[model samples]
Target: MRPVIPYLVSAGLFGLGVFGLLRRRNAVLLLMAVELMLNAVNLLLVTADTTVRAALPHSGQVFALFVIVLAAAEVGVGLAIVLRLFRLRADIDVDAIALTGPDATVALAATSPSLTSPTCGTPSATPGAAQ
Candidate 1:
């Protein structure tokens, strides 16, 4: 196979990740997008390590391992935050998040009716309304 194939696939995955990160409003989806981007980088790194004649043959693989570790840590922290937000507000829509001032929790509650209101999960106040 051509060396460029893996690079192109990696680029596509990175582009898809960026699109997902920008387009998604759910915190979990955003985290998944970040993981997608990290995997793309990992794929690129391993491909380079195997195909290129580098001074250190396993340098890219080592870096990819680091990225994997970082990605795992990131997922752990991100999920914790998401779970906390879900518990506090009963929702995980990122667009509804507005952490400002001393009354940060109240701010989100006041700004987004879908967050604290009775009709939160109903079609009357959809996640799109917060945006």
Candidate 2:
């Protein structure tokens, strides 16, 4: 078996993961791309374990397992945040979500006066609030 084959495959997987990460704007798709990248790393680790005669047997596999655990945790937290954002904004497009900059500051100031500095921008009172 040619050891180079696994390396090539791992490199391809990593490249695809990077492309997905860069191109996708949906929050869910972004998480999936991160998972893909983690999986690529796992693949590389396992392949290297097979290729190299390390003193500690299966250390790479152990590390791969750790990566899987980390990925699972990340997905859980990420999905929770995405769900909350969806509930709040009714949209999941990452490009539409801006946490900083002028637009965000203005929007935030309009929604809640306490969230923005008094000098930052004029806060608009919501409907039903006492004038």
Candidate 3:
């Protein structure tokens, strides 16, 4: 049970996670890659708890539990976003998505005319501006 072995395993897992994140384009796959990275972190934390002499016993395990909780929450939100994107656009290709492109700007303006030129009919809400 060499300490270096666990460290190397954790590093390898993290590397694979990073590779998946970079190579995958589907939103669901991206979330899975992030979960892989989080699991690697949990493995590292548990290994540290076993190997290191800490003042608080099992602190690393506690941190790992927290990470697990955080990962669950992250997966929930990420899946919700992916599902919403799929419903709206009928696809979840992350590479094809653009939140701030010209089309997005135009769509926003089309949806909310008040956000466009204030002269469209809605009074500008800016304080001390020329009416």
Candidate 4:
């Protein structure tokens, strides 16, 4: 049996998942998209395993197993982070987490003298001043 059709379907599903992940702002939707991508990969791996059973043995299946384990761990950690962000900010928008903004950069530069000065050992006379 030709495996091209199944591979194409899996590719289409993966593409859809990528689209959803990029376009959706909700954390749950993003997680669902990630799960879709993982399933698409698993489908392709299984299809490859079936087609190359004689030559490749069970390598593809083993790889699929590893991917499933990794996906589970990723979902767990990703959901935890999402929950924490939602609790702190009351929103799940990925764009809002700007840790390196202009204000933050300026504040860090002002506070850290070693970061702005060329002389690493010499301390400035003014407290918190760059050397």
Candidate 5:
């Protein structure tokens, strides 16, 4: 069918975005992957609108418009959060924030000591504690 090409391309783009989102640790790269996923969905909606018989009164176009608005909002909020994080830590590595390892968790906890307690200091003898 004539619409198959666009649908396949959209699917591929969505898959690529998913892969990038999962594999990349950079905040900017993650945002780009999100954009790619949004574009892919837009393309699929437009293609469906054009190919389907008895056209459905431009509902797809309306949906696409809402998606664009949502994407813009997402980008704005996401960038603001990323900027704040960068200001605080000076880096944009998503993996760094995960802090899955015990060492990482302890190090983060030590660095961010409680405001009301001076005794909440760095771990003195924990093995593998981050420097």
Candidate 6:
């Protein structure tokens, strides 16, 4: 019932969320850290609604609800992206994720002459056309 308890709790939650986000390497744990951050904000909003600002009664609660909804959508899309990443790479460690494979661009450049070729998009020979 202490007046400062809510503030302390919210601050602790936020701090833990930030720590988890920075420390975790797995994709799912990273997502959970983001959820922790969202929940911390929600708790702060509700605390302010009930105690600090009597003028605006339920506004903070309403905003908290919106945050919850946004967090839900974020989880859905985030998980799907993580699942796709897992399918492609067979691992979910964020440190292993890269914008491109180590040899992907180099292999493409080596095989495709289009970079310097005059007729890039057109194939050099038509298989069934008359010679």
* Top TM-score prediction, candidate number: 2
Which digits, one per residue and each the tens of the lDDT, describe model 1 over residues 34-125? Answer: 99999999999989888874677798899999999999999999999999989777899998777775467556556556565333444344
Model 4, residue 67: C-alpha shift (Å)? 0.6
Query: Residue pairs in steric clash, candidate 2?
Result: none
For candidate 2, the per-residue lDDT at 110 reads 51
- Backbone Cα, N, C clashes tallied per candidate: 0, 0, 0, 0, 0, 0
- Per-model TM-score versus the true fold: 0.78, 0.80, 0.78, 0.74, 0.76, 0.75
Residue-wise lDDT of candidate 3 within 1-131, one digit each (tens)?
67899899999999999999999999999999999999999999999999884667999999999999999999999999999888666788887665885777554454554566324545335578776
What C-alpha RMSD separates each model from the true structure? Answer: 9.1, 3.9, 7.6, 7.2, 5.1, 7.2
Q: Model 4 Cα displacement at 13 (Å)?
A: 0.6
Error of 6 at 9 (Å): 0.7
Determine which window of 10 residues in candidate 2 has minimal summed lDDT: 116-125
Task: Report clash pairs, candidate 3.
Answer: none
Ranking by TM-score: 2, 3, 1, 5, 6, 4
Query: Best lDDT goes to which candidate?
Result: 1
TM accuracy, model 1:
0.78
lDDT of each: 0.86, 0.83, 0.84, 0.83, 0.82, 0.82
| List of clashing residue pairs for candidate 6 | none
Query: Candidate 3: which stretches are off by over 4 Å?
Result: 105-131
Q: On TM-score, who's better, 3 or 4?
A: 3
lDDT (10s digit) by residue, model 4, range 2-88: 999999999999999999999998887899999999999999999999998999898889999999999999899999999987766
